[model samples]
Target: MNEQEFLASYDPRAYPAVAVTVDVVALTIREGALHLLLIRRGEPPFAGHWALPGGFVRPDEDLITGARRELAEETGLGGERLHRIHLEQLGSYGDPDRDPRMRIVSVAHLAFAPDLPDAAAGSDADEAGWLPVTALPGRQLAFDHARVIDDGVERARSKLEYTPLATRFLAPEFTITELRAVYETVWGQPLHAGNFHRKVLSVPGFVESTGASTERGGARGGPRAKLYRAGDARLLHPALLRPAREEAVR
Candidate 1:
């Protein structure tokens, strides 16, 4: 058919309507616990319910751009802070009835940042803050957000096993003890200190020594601990599997 005939025959409204959105599952460790960033919804469908920071994707923006834009809008994190955050596509969630208003599909993104400041609510959110993941069980999360948070948490837990992503949740330089705490907190279990230390050091390029020690002694008054920074390894050779995984399987 000719171009003019094809154009005239097509009907834009023939197909079912659908909308796309982006949601960010921003996770961080605060006070030795795992926390997820959330915003209180200000609009109906589920107004007042806490949810992952997100919004409808703008026609002019791509998925990742939309995700970052929604994050910045809800958290007020921009420039250096925003650029420093590690973001990745988590998954796409679009259960037929997930959205009450319409057939909406959301592309969720996962983010990790060193302890961040409180979030500032945007135009569509009533308030924004980081809430402990442990406290999410009984909470009323808007839409299918609770499931989204679960997926993000599982991704974080699994990534820490084979990737150096745990460092993304820590300061530039940290002690081995502090690094171990990141694992323990995210895994929601205790790790043997001696075993963890040995395994970490054995993983070449996992961390590098700075030839410096903390000015103060240990919290209980031992010799000063050595300081180290993230190394160049993209993946852990001998992945540090969570100790509780076997138990959970059983």
Candidate 2:
């Protein structure tokens, strides 16, 4: 058959229908705890239920763009406000019955941001806010969002072992104490301050000393803490391993 003839005969309806969506597991450290951005549905299919910020993607929109748009919409945050947040594709969920309506595949994204201001709900959400991940176990979640959040949390924990992404949850300049807190918060375990400081300093591109100290001293009224900024290295050569994982290998 000629190419033009084949094109003319093509019918998209011949096959089963499928839709694509983008769900973001946005994470941030607030008050020494890891929080996730959740929105309460104002419409059906899960009315009044809490879920990650996301929606069906526009036909012409890219995955990452759709993820960002949905996040901005549901959280009522502007693009500039979300610019510093690191967003990456976590994984794709496509179970046959994952969505009650048709076969919809969701590409989930994991985002890391600093402590942002309070959020206002968007059109599809009745309410929007950051909720601690630890507090979600008792709350009812919609769709496969529970598993998605689990994967997102694990992804963040594992990345901290090899990447400098934890710093994404901090300001432009921070003390090692603050950096350690981010790790401990995401990993849900205490990291030895001395060991963590040493490892961070030894890494080639982990951080660069800013040569400035905080204006205030420690809680105990000690010397001001030194400040450092994230460095040029994209990957840490000697990856920082969690204390338990570090011990298990030895």
Candidate 3:
């Protein structure tokens, strides 16, 4: 058959109708703790519950594009701010009964960045703001969002071990101490300061000295720590595995 004949014969209704949505798990460090952007739903099927910023995928846009759009609309992030976020697809979830109204396959995305501005609620949301992850257990999240948030946090934690993406959670120039804080915050544990500093410097291409130091001395009035910027290496030659994970594996 020709192209037109095949198109005419295709039956979209031959299978059960399914919807595709995009949810963003945007993470950042705020006040020395991990925070996530959440919006309170203003519509049905999970109305009035705090959830990740997301919504139905429009007909014309692609998956990643749709995810960005949802964040733009639901969280009121501008185009430039949205572009600064490091967004990547985490996975897709499509359990038969995941969504009460119908079958919905959510293409979940994970984003990380340096602390962002406060979120503003858009039309679909009653409220929006950054909530510390430690408080997630207290809030009633909608639409399997609790699970999604967990998965996204895990992804960020794991990536810190091997990828230099952790730098994305900081300014262009930062101190090793500041960088280590990012790992410590996301991993939910304190990393040894001396050990972390030595390992970071030893890692080839993990960071490069900027020939400068911080303006102020250490907290106790010690000498200023040297500054460094992200290096060229894409992967950490020797991954900085989580210490707890190491003990668990042993």
Candidate 4:
């Protein structure tokens, strides 16, 4: 068939309806533990169940925009706080039976934000808050969201080894100990303090000193530590591979 003839014959309505959605796996450290943003569904198909904050993509919106809108809406975050968050596409999940309401293809986005205040529930969510990642094992999460969260956590853990993305989980100026705690919390294991300190400083452009020190000493009362901010480098040279990964490969 000619191009014009083929176009005329096409019928979009003949195909089964499918919906696209965007879910955000927002992570941060609270009380020295890693937490994920979750919402209680206020509507049907799993009402009252906790799930990652998300919504169906609007017809006029792109995937990233849709994800950002959902994030802001569910968390009620805006202005400088909203702009400070770092977001990136994690992956897409589409199982024919993933959603009972219909066939849904979810483009999941991962976000890292500094410690935020209690979330204000949005229109679609009855309640919104940060849930500790370690506590998710026994809880019920709606619509295959548990799996999505697992993937996002793994992505965050892996990304930290080779990227400066971890800094997103902290304030603009942070101490090395604070940064190290971020790694420990996300990785779910304790990292060697001395080794971590050396590795972080050895990596060129990983962090830049702020030339200012904390007003007080360490939490235990020692000389104050110097502060630093995220540097310009996008990737780490001589990547700091996780110790567990090294053991597995050996």
Candidate with the greatest lDDT versus the true structure: 1
List ranges where model 3 is wrong by over 4 Å: 248-250
Compose the digit string of candidate 1's lDDT tens values, residues 1-250: 9999999999989999999999999999999899889988898979989999898999999998898898888677888788889999999999989998899999999999986878899888888898999999867899999889989999999999999999999899999999999999999999999999999999999999999999999879999999999999999998898876645755
Expressed as tens digits, the lDDT of each residue in 1-250 for candidate 2 is 9999999999999999999999999998888899999988898888999999999999889999899898787656775777667989999999999889899999999999896667778888898999999999987899999999999999999999999998898999999999999999999988889988999999998999899999999999999999999999899889999888998988
Tens-digit lDDT string for candidate 3 (100-209)? 99999999999898868788898878899999999999999998888999999999999999989889999999999999999999999999999999998889999999
Candidate 3 backbone collisions, by pair: none
| Ranking of all predicted structures according to TM-score, beginning with the best and ending with the worst | 2, 3, 4, 1
Candidate 2 overall lDDT versus native: 0.91
Deviation in Å, model 2, residue 230 alpha carbon: 0.4
Q: List TM-score per model, in order.
A: 0.93, 0.96, 0.95, 0.94
lDDT of 4: 0.90
Worst 10-residue lDDT window, candidate 4: 74-83
TM-score of 2: 0.96
Where's the lowest-lDDT run of ten residues in candidate 2?
74-83
Structural RMSD, model 3: 1.5
Runs with alpha carbons beyond 4 Å of true place in candidate 1: 1-10, 246-250
Q: Per-candidate RMSD vs. true structure?
A: 2.1, 1.3, 1.5, 1.7
Q: After superposing candidate 4 on the true structure, give the runs of residues whose Cα lies further than 4 Å from its correct spot.
A: 1-9
Best-fitting candidate, scored by TM-score: 2
